[model samples]
Target: MTAQPNSTEARDMAYHLHSYTNPRKLEREGPLIIDRGEGIHVFDNSGKRYIEGMAGLWSVAVGFGEKRLVEAARRQMDKLPYYHTFSQKAHGPVVDLAEKLIGMAPVPMSKVYFANSGSEANDSAIKLVWYRSNALGRPEKKKIISRIKGYHGVTALSASLTGLPNNHRSFDLPLANILHTTCPHYRTGAEPGQDELAFSRCCAEELEALILEEGPETIAAFIGEPVMGAGGVIVPPEGYWAAIQDVLRKYDILLIADEVICGFGRTGNMFGSETFGMRPDIMTLSKQLSSSYQPIAALMINDSVYEPIANEADRIGALGHGFTASGHPVAAAVSLENLAIIEEKDLVGNVRRLAPHFLGRLNALERHPLAVEARGIGLIGALELEAADGAAAGATGARVGAILQRNGLICRNIGDSIAFCPPMIITAAEIDEMFDIVEASLGELGQQAAA
Candidate 1:
């Protein structure tokens, strides 16, 4: 059906250029204009509600229409609408939020630097790594290694750090110094007959090989998501992080845990780093930090990563790296309140409680014919799709996504994987309902195929 003239969809087709969309198809089909949100549900313009299976992009820890966050923003905006952290100027909200993040860190952290989004936070982190390298007089130690299919962000530098091809294709990205090694998906990356342990060791060996090929003295850092999010929710095989960390230690390389999706109770723990045995020197956080209520992201550095940079800055008289909205008081305020709600309500506990049900339902999908594999941890998971009757690679997933949308669930299709990351506030009953829709959607696909 075509969009009515001057309608919201029509205007969107006429004016808006969406990200990650096929523009031509959007012009023909228009958009699903979300009107408002409450709890784990969002209503479209025509008042159709969706379960928000992806948590508004794998964030929104405390759920939507959270009144406390609104109140926090209002109070801070009224008291101090805007402030910059430049020239040693600081505000209460930013200071409090930073302190809160540092105190809540999975490992010891020295300082928290704020940014408006994950992209900027990663970009800033890379710059800091380069800065730290320069400060330590190891200017050649600047190449940062990420993993294949890892999702960092979309900025020039961060996009390069990201391991996805589309993120780099035609964007002239990956600049210089950003490299990608092996992805640790046992089913996808391992050779035939390779067990999880062997594959895990192979991943580490490949990483070390890459480091040696690049000259280990030149490798500055290795960055990764604790549980790969956009890369089809690929949970690392057993002993994966331990093996990887061993390599980094041998080379004295820093680890940058991109906790944008795995932070803030999404992964059954406060941070994915705790869930996995990752000892990162620097960490980039966003998405759930403020639950996308207000745009905010932060980077935390341990003393091992910060001291040399601090000394270097002291010698040079400045760090000279930051974003204008680094710690916007209102954003920081909402984030602080968001964290309070997560703790006071024991959202992490909720995740731990419901994760078995969530994963049970997710893993059960493997019984379906179209399911190639099922993977996940905590509250995040995905059912990978195999094309029916030799259809295109992602065709099955695309069809499943459309069916789930019509069935009142909004989830994301990353490549051929149908990801379900509902809000942490979701109940056990809600988990059943969410999977009911998913199961029915896949069943419908089967029915259509059989017919």
Candidate 2:
């Protein structure tokens, strides 16, 4: 055992600045330094192993320590370490990856622009929408709308596009033209006797009203996640996307599908756009593109959106926008190889076959004392804990999450909901193991609540 640090916890507290974390709480609790991973499991510094339930923040589609991906990165690094796609410059790997992405797009996509992360991809998407609207002589159509619980990304415009309160509070976000409508969660948002179809209509009506209230001419785009990931794994009500798309079409507003989390077989589809019947004018892709083996992302746009943006760029001398590491050759190569592996191994098929089993097991937890709701689609699921004695649910979700960590499972707590997004490579037996631990933890929590 590599001589454990004398004051490792204190050292982490002193040096690291974590994202989306309570800094003070981090100072007190310290970091849980993960050492390495194999397959769908990761090991900590103490050699304790735990299933990577959230796929390392909902990326890592191929799981960890994938040798083929590592080899792809190495081969690309040796041949052409790095290159930029700016100022008309490009490389083979980047070009090939872009072609593959455009070809694989669920809807007909005219172009693919590369970026370094989901946030950057989404931020670029926002800029493209505004630029395209301006090029078409609709500068007033600069406002973007997203759902209240929908998560886009964390950069300036993207964060504004994100509808979560925490992403906006004290940051002065939602930056002027961004607007958020209602979250279409039937279990939580539905009125008495309101069925899924009724809830879907309500969502559509509410969205149309918002557009009218703001004047549809002011709205340029509407962005959404097909299956809400960070905001409690909210799968939309039936007919939700169809109704929402009708509203967008009626107003001539573009739809931007933020597939950062659900892309690349998470929902048993190549893209969530296909699964949810979303024909987005623009789509953002990341997370599973390189299976978290490399830091990369892509923004795909259809001909309608791309043609205007391209024409505008020609008129402006240059787009004047790009990241230094956009389409990095090494990342692109690895991403291509990752996609090949996903296809070769029939990972999407696995997800489709296993989804019903996973959902069945998760739904069984609904009647548990600590579980108020059990919701999931494909491999992503959540168990929402109810408040004890009417106190407040989700308040204790994080505490329960910590307990789950102690019980040898690693998942996420999103506002009183315990989210599970195991890697797509996880087997049926492993699924049983994961939920067994979850059941144990819930049982303990239930006993504690009763006491």
Candidate 2 root-mean-square deviation in Å: 2.5
lDDT at residue 44 of model 1 (Cα atoms): 99
Q: After superposition, which runs of candidate 2 have C-alpha atoms over 4 Å from their true positions?
A: 1-8, 390-393
List model 2 lDDT by residue over 253-299, tens digit each: 99999999999899989888889899999999999999888999999
Q: lDDT: which candidate is best?
A: 1
lDDT of each: 0.93, 0.91
Clashes of each: 0, 1
What's the TM for model 1?
0.98
**Candidate with the greatest TM-score versus the true structure:** 1
The residue-by-residue lDDT of candidate 1 on 311-367, one tens digit each, is 999999988988888899999999999999999999999999999999999999999
Clashes of 1: 0
Stretches off by above 4 angstroms in model 1 are 1-5
